[model samples]
Target: MTAGRPAPAGPVWDRPEPPSRAALSPLSRERIVAAAIALADADGLGAVSLRKVGAALDAGPMRLYGYLSTKDELLDLMADAVHGEIELPLDAGWRETLRALATGIRAAALRHPWFTELAGGRPNIGPHALGVMEAALAALDRSGRFADIDEMMSARGTVTAYVIGAVRSEIAEQQVERASGVSEAEWRTATGPYLKRMLATGRYPTLARFVREGADRSAEEWFTAGLETVLDGLGQ
Candidate 1:
């Protein structure tokens, strides 16, 4: 009965359209995570911040809040995304399955060094990370070597501990090289005289022998040898 209100304009849906605005690509968690990954890859984990990530994606930091609540969440996404790069083998023997997982993780860590920095401290419960863990546990269970689930989990933890420690060592060596602008060989050569002097004191016979006779293995070879030793221990 309030006829003076002009029928309430027949609903807002009947209103005329406003001028069109420029169309921008919609934001997504994937995009945000990807942007953060790229930043970490380029400049290391310290370089990654929500504002920088948002700038990388051409969005404001506040806009990213809709997709993730905190930078830690974004990092968890990035870590899982890196995990997604690992290839899960099919129908392989237990040893082969574990080898594939370990090597795939190593490869991924080499590509994204920041990943090793976040590897153990934070809980990686994302889907891809969980998939990798699931694959390893299943392989361990199928091997029938473990006495029980407890032993199986222990084996998994041992292998993971080795991998994370080994990869962190590798990445640290790499960072040292990158920072010093000196290759490992170059550094060894530069320090050769000092090392020789120290070794001459006879305080490090084993190490001196190692320095003289150690096999000149690449990083990959070292990683594989260590991994194989761990696998053998698990087998026994």
Candidate 2:
């Protein structure tokens, strides 16, 4: 060997190699979304971010970019993943199937409160979300009960809209209770004076009567009653 110029850095292989990244958690779109969903479920949707999700996997935020281009895409993926969870029966009739679908969707929303919060932020045309829609549509269309196509489609929309609206309200209350550590009924009781003052104004006679006579409705009772009302409207 000529032994010149510090031996030419000893054939380059003598340089120390990077400590193998083998210990790093492998990441994928599904894994990233799952991490985000887990964070959201444990905390709330506001808590999910690329940095937080990556940290959950013990990786860096840049690793998530390959899988999710933007935060909205991750949210969409999380919503659709929940959509895939709604269990459907193999051969239930239209009314029964739609009812079950609505019920399952509500259960899923309650299971993941952030789901109801983000679902309406974007149109969920992802595969699983579309699969849910197609399943409900196929079931409804097969019944041939409506006078026209518009009616049938509207029926699907009615059920979907009702469930989204109802579950969103239910979950918002649950989250508020969690955050404030005060039950909703307790909050209402705390605000009873304002309600009575408003009632004294005599602006809402119907509301006043309901307040005086109506039994306290549980979340399920409210949701089920609203769902049945929507279903009854669709049956016409």
Candidate 3:
């Protein structure tokens, strides 16, 4: 309390060292992309950003610049990372392999709804994506049904396009159900009257038949049926 004369120091235990900041988690491109995917999964694709990813990873956004140059690159990384989840059939024939592969992609899209908006949305030359492409090429060529590059590419393009379109529809329905706060069955029941009204107009005879027949299938069933038809056409 008095002037500086060298006061007695407190006990070592009483004057303990101050706690310092905890160490930050290790940073890498995989960690960054994984954090972004987690954010996107919890919230949505719109929620993913460099700042949020950094926060999720306990690192500053600037640290990610070394691995991901820009937000676009981050998105590509996230997309390709998801592509790594697909289950490819190694020894199956072209039709079976392509069918399984496409179904797997759709399943992955369902698992990560954001994937529907990503895969093939850009020039995905990433390794996992390229690997999938390579597998598809090998499967299609293994049939020996396709003579050359053009045929092979066309077959691959057709299946790829089909998978993308089918998954887009699946994602759209899911988004609608999520936004409406209702399951698909509930939403359909809620709108049954309007759909019936629209069908009753007689202008949509085919639509009326579909509604009246109530011929329906699960999303997976529908996708499989459409894929079988496409494969049939291609084989023929």
Model 2 scores a C-alpha lDDT of 0.80
Q: What local distance difference test score does each model get? A: 0.84, 0.80, 0.81
What's the lDDT for candidate 3? 0.81
In model 1, residue pairs whose N, Cα or C atoms come closer than 3 Å (at least 3 residues apart or on different chains), thus clashing, are none
Question: What order do you get sorting by TM-score, best first?
Answer: 1, 3, 2
Candidate 2: 10-residue stretch with minimal lDDT: 5-14
In candidate 2, stretches whose alpha carbon ends up further than 4 angstroms from where it belongs are 1-23, 197-203
Better model by lDDT, 1 or 3? 1
**Candidate 1 per-residue lDDT over residues 33-90, each given as its tens digit:** 8888888989999999999988887888877765666667678779889999999988
Worst 10 residues of 1 by lDDT: 5-14
TM-score of each: 0.88, 0.81, 0.85
- The candidate that achieves the highest TM-score relative to the unseen native structure: 1
Could you give the candidate ranking by lDDT, starting with the highest?
A: 1, 3, 2
- Candidate scoring better on TM-score of 1 and 2: 1
